[model samples]
Target: MYVEGLLSSLTRVKKARSLRAASWDTTGRNNDAWNIEPNETRVLADIKGPGCINHIWMTQRDGYRNVLLRAFWDDEEHPSVLCPLGDFFGLGNEIVNSYDSLLFSASTAGNNQFNTGCALNCYVQMPFNKSARIELVNEGDEMHRQYFYIDYELYEQPLDDEVAYFHTQFRRENPCDGWGHEIRVNTPEANIVNAERLAWDNNYLILEAEGRGHYIGCNLSITNFQGTWWGEGDDMIWVDGYKWPPDLHGTGSEDYLNQAWGMQPNAFRHNGSSIYEPDTDGYQTSYVFHLENPVRFEKEIRATIEHGHGNHLRNETSSVAYWYQLEPHKPFGILPVQQRKPVLRGEDGGWLINETAQTQQAEPTLNDEMKQLKAQWAEKQKTEA
Candidate 1:
């Protein structure tokens, strides 16, 4: 059955021959005419990449006011186990709403920096058994020549089969000047931390940080782009499938008590102000997260802002592009050590709570039910004997 599904998805791409070569004219516009809608519920395409096949599902609704791009591994039965390549932000239960606008553009003027009214040239590259790299050039405004790179690696395990883990990193490069860049994780439920600048290597700015769980998110934005003309950039990590408190709060809800939940260093600003706002403008951001240890799977993501510049306001023309590593039978739900201060209360009996004591407590109801069931089975066996 799985083999049949895989073959069906592969043969579903009607325009496979057109995409054999790297052609900008074949992307983002009417020329990119692959849709997974109507009678063809599933759309699959084979691209020149490290993967056997890539599955793409296109959904349109409300008189075509909305369009969605859903991509996953063609080999996996459970597509949700893989990270999707598009604006996938919303309550955990609901379908992830698509980006308001997604288009592709090109420029011959070397570095294609993002600016107001500037279009972008973007696409996804999935390689079989190898890592994929995306190239971006700044063309619009020279003042915004700064670019950010985010890479994601997704992995899985064999013991437990419920969840998939992701390890992601971000890198920012300033080509024109020393500007401050802000990195924002769109998902509300992400635990983000350990942001710092490390040593540079191979013309890439290396920033290192660690985060676990789903809602843990991170971002890096250039504040003042000075005389630095494309050196290296910084990096950060995103661990998926784990949920934290900040992610529970949803988007734009500020918690003063949880200052650590916000951006670290808190020193640089876009316009010399100490405020960190999410980038709604259409710019390119990449993400990669890999689940290491126990199981090994890798996921790669690329997000590009298609239209305008950052004026500290929201704009359309943004889209997310991604690829995934799918491995079945991976164990999940191993919680990481909490880094924030726990909520405490004066003990008046009932349950005395301390950090160590609280950690020792077993899960309620579920554990009790299992214990009762075991006791009942034991008694029934004894009676039968």
Candidate 2:
């Protein structure tokens, strides 16, 4: 569904004011990337709106989980959106294996070569009554060079009181507890045995909130070391105080993400796999945006999934859930930089092969500045604590 930009409904709207905010430097010679200093919070957009954000596009040379992106709507102290910059665009784990979907898409240049450039884009319509502010804070060790464009529409009239605000939140639990490989079983057997055990006592939280709105969708990425496929887990969504048998439940992880059988790294216009690691085995990224089948909620919604049926499979999982909900959202965790970064099993003090470090294909050597800065930051934090 390629939108003919010039003829799209966006520009065709009668009597609406359109605006663009870009990082265009005053001097054309060095006008590209916005050099965002480490530990600095950059205000990306601050605009009064009774309008809607039509599209947002950005790219930066920084690790995904390292740089945090947040947004506040209608002058609320609490942000409506909070997640890793890359993860926010369905590029979790900071690995930019180019992917494209309806609302989110990202790609890296020179795919097979070294020193690849990155491109990220998102198109989620956000409506607000009073105002909207977006911020990006660099939590990485070095300064990040960011380039962005925020496109929005200002309407003549205020938004309807019943309209919901867009919200997105990220969550992760690396290396979730898994039963030993010796006990690993097939999907059918696992489901039957884990049926009752698939209770909500232990499940990955995709989106949890007390509000009235329908969920749009989510992007889920998994890094598994075990040989057993992790799709045995089911999607269980509880709406409005569901206790016995949730209001919505799916057969498996792939089913919930709107894929059948196994998943391939095919990035489609709406729902499909984003990344499939060939160099690193057992890594895959999937995304789905619910347009026609969006789940509605009157009071609350708990979007969750079992990482493995009966919580038997263990692996690294990261996700960003998207939806539009009432004001005053439930709190989203703001993990420290170190905690946000992915970790491996055992006591090894290093990151596994990920978007940030495709070291398996090439050496991911950090310069002296970054090494020293990370060390200094760690020491400073220890002292402060």
Candidate 3:
């Protein structure tokens, strides 16, 4: 939002010393990039702190979704940031469409390659008191040639005790357990006439953390498999211990991303849809950064969304949640490399339907009257057709 005078702070008396860790040719040659072999992990930045990482810029020949990016603060055993390299940068599903955002961006060669050479950057402030370690794990089978820079500001004084550590976690629900796949969205019969959400045990979880923290936002990616509009779900975020009624309940998917009607191909500083393929080949990527109003929490936060109205649409979904929290964070382990791999796109540039894909659907316990209503609705559809 600081559109005009963003550089005004540059004139202020700077107290911190600027520093950087980068991949430079030790031989003073132009071959500065490192070739990371399969399964090889490289330390991008390991620095002592009382420092704040101001910026990070990186590029690789083919840093697809299989590559894992992790960051640990204060030498913690578990990393605070763990996400697919591409998702962490903004785009998702290994499909790169470069766009600039306030916190993260990807710059491409203008060809719009699905997952190829691109420069990725992150400008989220990451202040650490003791130490910080950033590593990249090449989980794909091919060798990855990567170049990078981690710019930080070293402070002579220790960071404020109240300063929280930055954190990110990725999650995916390939073919989210959705009921009523046979039903089309917006159909009269598809309406939640008798539906009710007694609980959110089956919601697609974007983040579930147990600690003192504030959720900044998340990047959500979806590939429509149902052949129609794939965004009829609602966003429900629970901070502290509220159950049935969440702390921040949203109306619909597009509404949650700050769009109306449907998602558009737009990228702004705080909120916008980075990718919007709104057809049967629906592949959309959107983000919402709560920079001005972070969802604060004292104990915990559980952020989730429905796959469709009442959790009734089946589609591929994945996301990365960004936040800042205290140390000793709850361990949110990531999916295996195989599971984290991007789903193959069809010849038509849509996700290939995987019939054998496992589903995590949680069918609600329906009473006799509700079950009868559902059966009657099915029979009515057959008769109408």
Candidate 4:
């Protein structure tokens, strides 16, 4: 009987539990599930399931804007189980620590609404062992359809055995024009020991992160074109500290640090704006930089940019300057070790670019919060051990 009970419990936990129709719109109008308008609103749905729940599905009305989705599970004290949608893709990190449902909003114009006419769907799934799934459907008369599926599975043991690995697969189909879409993976606290971006044959950008306790990785494909011409593209990086003057020639002091760096025409240009002198027969070039230490604290900065233009391209500039967290490591070298294979994968998709990886040690000084988190993670390690 005891064995049967345990097996039943495991089976119950493994199966997904969903919200009943009676509780669909407990907080708002009876529009089936959460009905959000042109403004940002937080909604909650009680998730009841056994075992570690690891997936979430979100469906929005048509014309949604600034849509932010998050998930929190009932684990030891209801700690947040998923990273904020913003921080997931190096886009933005805003912590919305609530045990309820995720956050959603319409665009600034208030013209775009979610789940009104057609369904706009977003999903979050854990790729370890735990699984959670949420889905939204629109019963109204709108002409938009956005649907995505995120698969999450948990391994009994981590890949490296030292850190936990969360593998995510996101697939989306949007038939509307001028609509924006992105898939993000966020780490609540920044402990990215090292991050690298590689351009493969001018088609995709592979973002890789590595460090103790966690590793975040993603590949972003260049699909649409808006402002200017479009084709396969190259990749670029922007450090935190650097600043690019708007108008270089009109600037007061030509002796600016970046100006000085720009004066030296090495294999690559560090600062200032320059156009691809098509008449000059501009050839392809690869740029790479590596910081010595991992970024442990929360900071907003542009890390890299992928230049997508024809041979005679212009208007390329680096705004922010980055200081090597590690000592005088070379900026231009063969792409880092982990990026080579992935670069090939990207090239298969059509981005033509080289790879360079830099390795160095960053300064040892860490902020108080980072130190505290490290300590807590360490304690958790000890308990698990």
What shift in Å separates residue 9 of candidate 4 from its native position after superposition? 16
> What TM-score against the true fold does each predicted structure earn?
0.24, 0.83, 0.91, 0.29
Q: List where candidate 2 sits over 4 angstroms from the true fold.
A: 1-12, 110-116, 180-182, 185-198, 344-385
State the TM-score for model 4: 0.29
Worst 10 residues of 1 by lDDT: 306-315
Stretches of model 4 off by over 4 angstroms after superposition: 1-31, 37-40, 45-51, 72-124, 127-229, 235-305, 309-385
lDDT (tens digit, per residue) of candidate 4 on 1-385 = 4456513755545434332222244467654544434333333433333323233333333322134333333222212222223212211111111111121111222211112432222222232223233322222233323333332433344223222322222211111111111101122222222212112222121222222222121212211212232222223322333244211111111122123312222222222211111211221111222212222212222333232221111211111111211111122212111221111114344433332311222223444654664565566558869
lDDT: which is higher, 2 or 4?
A: 2
Predicted candidate 2 versus true structure: per-residue lDDT over 1-385, tens digit per residue: 6577623865554767889877878687767768888899999889898888888988766657788889899999888899888788887665666777888877786342212357888888888889989888889888888888989878878878788999998877665554432234353324333333245646677888887898989999887766557676788888897675788888888888777876766878778877764433555678888887899998899888877765555567778899998787786766677756654434462336444432112222334543454455556558869
List candidate 1 segments past 4 Å from native: 1-44, 47-67, 80-125, 129-326, 329-385
lDDT for 235 (candidate 1): 23
Report the error of model 1 at residue 25, Å: 11
lDDT per residue (tens digit) for residues 1-385 in model 1 = 3456514855654422222222223446643323333222222332323322222222211111022222333243323222111122110111122121121112222221211111122222232332222222111122112111222222221213323222222222212111112211231111122122111111121222222222123222322212111112222122232222211221221221123233332221111111122231112222222112111113322122101011111111111112223343222121111211111223542222344422222222223433444455556558869
Better of 3 and 4 by lDDT: 3
lDDT value, candidate 3, whole model: 0.81
- For model 3, residues 1-385, the per-residue Cα lDDT tens digits are 5544756877668798899999999898999898889999999899998899999999886766878999999989999999998899888877777788999988887434577788889999999999999999998888888899999988889888789999999998877776566667766645663222543676789999998989999999987777688887788998897665688888888888888887876888988876667421467789999887999999999898877776667678999999999888998788777666556676876665554553344555555543554676798888999
lDDT of each: 0.23, 0.73, 0.81, 0.25
List all candidate RMSDs to the true structure: 22.4, 11.9, 3.1, 22.3
